[model samples]
Target: MATADPRLRSRAQQQQPAPVAPPPPPPPPAETTPAMGLDGSGDAPESSGTSSDDSFKLKFCTVCASNQNRSMEAHLQLATAQLPTISFGTGSLVRLPGPTINQPNVYNFNSTTYEAIHKELADQNTQLYTQNGLLNMIGRNLNIKKYPERFQDWMPGKPRLDHKGDQGYHGTESGVVDVIFTCEERCFDAVLEDLHNKGGRMNRPVHVLNVDIKDNHEEARVGGQAILDLALSLNNAASEERKARGETGWDRGSGGARQGFDEKVPEIVAAWQERWPTLPALWSLAWF
Candidate 1:
């Protein structure tokens, strides 16, 4: 039994109601041993006050239309937690709103750096960009990474360049990511289609999820926090499975926490969705 009596706690303090049978298991996510981690005889799993967030970090990738606001916000959040993360844009070219709506500023996703974009925009018309929040958005992007990366141009198993000496996530260095989150449905579609076109050259499985976030600062902040929470929840689940299976890393040739973690994704996301109802989420398994 828990140290504190369940009856004494108020209803608000009680655990939230279990989610309604998770949306058809988005691809047969497994029903783990049970929420308690208890056996048939009803013995609860061992307890620990320490968090598992930093114990094992999942390699993540965040994607958005132009990788300016939402994705970068999520990148910042994951990096802030010291999680291994990379980010990208799904657009053909990076686009930012210019002084006039028709004359949007466009840049080469591969050649332009966030710093360069920030400086140019600041010099062109500081007040306009600042008032429109473009400068502020790119300013944050500059702090998180060097430039906007195109998901279409990403080559699996190839490490990131300019990773060192940046205020980015310097956790485990690997070009591959375990999960890919897109900030919009169209971007998610682009990612899925792109992955289909690539056809798994790396032979590594990855999860692609979409969380619809409006292109705005306030919404991005809320979505970023939600993404971080989801990341932590996922890491916690994977860490538990790792402990149960005596595994050390994510992949081990057809055996490891990866399988269990994949199986539980539906339930985990479902629980997370219950909290952030306004932000709709989508999930699917793909390869890199």
Candidate 2:
């Protein structure tokens, strides 16, 4: 073979060095890596205080036929049960948007009974106005003055029902409510239909409990007691459930804890029936 030029030989030798691949491009900025700049297993997952299942709030709407005796009684009873996280209100016009009927006699009935109850409570020094903590009591324990400011003007015996078709009941915008209690089948049907059609705060699921009041005394005494009993028992179950689950909120000790209506309502209903036999004929539990 012919001898190669020294310069050419040197060039060939330099070129002969094996090809070397550039280092693999730095791994794409690991998007999965947490912002803390630590690799996997380095950081904790985001922690929101509330449980994922507990995202929704619980609300109760006590709707009744007249909103006078039966429904009003139920509302008062439910209010007193004082479940920690629930909100309560009573009236034919509260959630309704349109005008409501007026009972000229309502002022007479609601005022007289309310004042009598208020005066009695005042003597006991448990007057609602005097004691902020006792405002939610109803029926035998009701404090008219301590009634919520929104309900301050409500007359107990007064006809809460506006006979004129001008009135309507509507739930608020706070959020979806879990339950609705109505006294009597007619009332339950009407209220449910209204909620189904004209929806808002009540846009969520609801449960209806009807009360039967065939007679005036039963309407007044048994009706009130049954409603109250239902509320108290239901709330109590919720409290127990919450306690078991380690939930923290208001009125935990006093049976005021929010509960899943579906989970606790059946037991509550059974408990209520056991407490008051008359309650069975009037009540129907439904969910929507």
Candidate 3:
């Protein structure tokens, strides 16, 4: 037989070993799936990054136009839900007041039966003026009668430290920010401008949660529940894995005021603040 060419034989043997196909590209990174946090809700995660201001730990901030119905409900829900990798707050440092309660001849602060409400908002500098027209407007815009049980249970009767453990807007970003959120389109734009001017989060991701404002108290309550559920889902997504593995440092105190809801709320809020860093203007709505 003719002597086979060594180079050609070697090449043929190598090729014959088996046409091993190149490993397929890694599924294109799974498309990032909308940043849904812990709660299983589709709510996007806030940005995470080092802030220009090293002193503060807010590499991100959530911007909302007014700390009233929609935004305040989101704040409370996020606080209670314990979202991970993110913090929550209104755009400006001003505190927000809860909705107005029914009263008679409430001209000044003391004259009003809802003085605690006043103080609650006062602490945060949230001034909400509820006229008779606003009530009608709330009735038209929201369905308060939907979730009465939840309203009675979670709604803060009187806004107190509701700060979820003495926490307030530090007014600076000095932490890792995963994203920023806004409650309303307007607020989102304003925050965008601020970020653009300050080069916010060194060009991080941002989300907008556009929601309608409610004049009716009960409708706002329903909306609050929706927000709470969404917040819980998002929060759960980030921390559930860690919590399931017996992780601590997220306000797991044994007893005291934090025995139940009190302790859990602040812990969740703090955790969220640390992770999300920034929020846009919009309501946290959950689908399915």
| Model 2 per-residue lDDT tens digits across residues 1-288 | 111222122211100223233222112122222111111122422221211223322345554432334444444334333321222233333221111234122222233333343344344343322333211222222221212212223222233233221111122233234555655555544544444334223122345566665523335444655665555555455546666664554222222343443456666676667767765533333222
Q: Write the per-residue lDDT of candidate 1 for residues 80-186, one digit (tens) a residue.
A: 66667888998889988987789999999978987788777776777676567776567556656678889889886776655774444565355778888889888
- lDDT comparison, 1 vs 3, better candidate: 1
lDDT by residue (213-261, candidate 3, tens digit) is 3424454444445444434434344343444433343222222321232
Scanning candidate 2 in windows of ten residues, the lowest lDDT window is: 6-15
Give me candidate 3's TM-score against the actual structure.
0.34
| lDDT of every predicted structure (CA atoms) | 0.69, 0.36, 0.30
- Candidate topping lDDT: 1
Query: Ranking by lDDT, best first?
Result: 1, 2, 3
Error of 3 at 68 (Å): 3.2
TM-score of each: 0.79, 0.42, 0.34
